[model samples]
Target: MKYGKTLVNDVKTTLKVLVLFVPLPIFWALYDQQGSGWTFQATRMDGYIGFYTILPDQMQVINPLLILIFIPLFTYLIYPAFAKCNFLKTPLQRMVCGGLLTAASFGISAGVSFALEATEPSLPTEGNCQIRIYNPLDCNAILTAEPYIKNQDIKTMGYTNLDIPNVYGEKVVDFSITGCDGKINYQTGSNLSVIEKETLFYYMLPDSFVRGQDDIERDENGLPKIRTLVNKRVEDFNLTYSDSEKDVLNLPSNDDSLFSINPGSYKVQSFPKELKFYLGGVYTVLVSLDNNNDVQNVEYYEVTQPNSVHILWLIPQYVVITAGEIMFSITGLEFSYSQAPVTMKSVLTAAFLLTTAIGNLIIVIIESAKIFEKQSEDFLLYAGLMVLDMILFGLMAMKYKYINMEQNSDNEELENKSERKESNAIDNPTFKHNDDDA
Candidate 1:
């Protein structure tokens, strides 16, 4: 009877210890999803919804909701099935089932990733292109104008002609070329030569002309003779010959000159042709049009391409991470309580709960460090912290030993016996007291 009573007490104690550790680990595992799986999943989602952006951290609520809804169901339905199945009687069997489920969840997410990747943009098409062009101008506006010649003649010799204005409104004499309609006339007393008029259009000259001193040939009177007549009369000069030589001399003079001419006003007849160009296979010029009626200028451009696949790759990683959370966090809580002595069961449960709280606090600290700061660097720091945690957990696993309640009974009994002895000594004192005095 005593043996049966001790066995029943041992079972009760084991159950009580399991109860403390079991819930804490589960809660920890559920909480850990916020950092791992949820975080990874959120990277793939459109955070913005009609100008209302959803933070990745806020998605963590899903894990807690799942826990709240499923914990009781598992306790009532799934736990009973494990107990009745006989095949899953051992804790290792239960752990294996949990691991398989976790892995299966990850597998499902991997399938989702594959599907997402299949839909991802592979080449430059609509929805993935970004192109922006600044202000555009007409090509005709940049073309230089052709040069021409003009001439004027003073019929009476030795009389200065004045008030004659060039096309640019500059007062100057004019020179003309003797062409098919006009012939050169030379007299014995004074010979006449046809001179060319120089028409100045838009021209750009260097500043060196302004910096240097004027170099001109002078007559015996010390006054400079006109080596180049800007605008002069062809009839006033003496001509020795006529032919291509005279025509060559009549050509407009080429000199470094600067002047602003009115731009040619012409209505653009058609739109500019699109320039078909490619920037990698993933990016191309989609549509371009000259909306301004300037055929030489492109006023509108539209570039398109497929969306990126980076987000698709993140979802599977999230699921695997979430699975790890279930295994390490929830299972660790169960293990903590099961290993603890009956007297310290509450402390073990608290320890299990503390790990999750610490994980959450670490996340808060990391986020706070970036509060009011721009995210310039990649999130490698957070990744490093996770790696550190995994390493620490692995080290702990190496040193950890499962608690065996059956073997710990002697220690519990010793503690109980010591307590009973102390209590008896306190109740029945060996020394003579007030009764002996009476």
Candidate 2:
């Protein structure tokens, strides 16, 4: 009776419990990218941090290091300082503050990518050809681009990806990729201009390399079917939007808007109007106006020109998001226990764990949807969502009245004593084990 009463009667406790889950999935989704997607981003950026050259995967170590620094610093120093200033007196307030910081960090991360996009991909190289294989698995794989390139071994265990260094110095570098199942599938790319090093992008994946032994399976046609990406051309789009929608899109000014359904099938751009693709790449633009609202869909593509940006650019987002994790995740755990009635504490704890699991699942769902292609826009959307969560939670938190745990414990003790007295008077055989009753 007491357990069920406590569970149902505690309106304030229910609200506080809901607060624990409101923004959790969003937080975890972004947090998880630090290990998976963010590491991929690190692959493309220059990894030389001061004097140390950090590997892409090793960049995840910064989160734990930051957590170690945050725990003591926030507990002993920062929280106390904030308390003195009359803010962050409640866990909810601290969580909101942390969420803002997290948003800022993602904003900074997007800024770095934006900066990289602004630069033209230009590099001078004396080498004839280079062969790169993107091996995602831990096992060593051999790569060969026949005729112009051959027998290039790639190891992805410790390194991000392998650029067969020995293949350089040849003048006619052919970009050929012979996959295990078909004809050569490959990319044409300019070496990211470095002072003296090669550049690579973690966000992109190299095709599975073909082995020397697999060459015998080729059909007798001497020519093999080429693998192709499904790039839908912009001309194929059936767009319906007002002038306001066009302005909102803010497409690149260099790309000409003129088009004609021709008698002779001729096409033209105003001087500089070649397709606005990244150097050594082709792209298909996706446009739409069926949104039913004023909101316009905008997309910008970047074919990263190897090592164009600094890796230090990722630090701001990492710092901000880590600070958020300390505030929300760490404090949310403690808050859940504090507010839960003794009989329902375990239930509340399990609910909190459920939020994290669901949060991970959200990332998998979003990726499979394939709707969000740009990382920058995605970061902004996440930041906006978190801010909205903070607003909603802040409102709910304002109405919450904390439970007096010590008082509840005392009442519980009294109830237990009264029950024992009743059992003693009844001379119940199940309750007769204790010798002190004699």
Give the lowest summed-lDDT range of ten residues in model 2.
260-269
Top candidate on TM-score is 2
- The candidate maximizing lDDT is 2
TM-score of 2: 0.53
Tens-digit lDDT string for candidate 1 (121-218): 22312222111111111111111111212232212111111121222322223222222111222111111111122211111111110111112111
- For candidate 1, which ten residues in a row score worst on lDDT? 203-212
In order, what lDDT does every prediction score?
0.35, 0.51
Off by over 4 Å in 1: 1-41, 46-58, 87-92, 114-332, 350-415, 418-438
Q: lDDT (0-100) at residue 132 of candidate 2?
A: 25
Off by over 4 Å in 2: 1-20, 49-52, 119-305, 419-438
> Which tens-of-lDDT digit does each residue in 214-304 have in candidate 2?
0111111111111111111233333321221121122332222312110111111111222222111212222212224211222222222
- Cα TM-score per model: 0.34, 0.53
Model 1, residue 432: what's the lDDT?
62
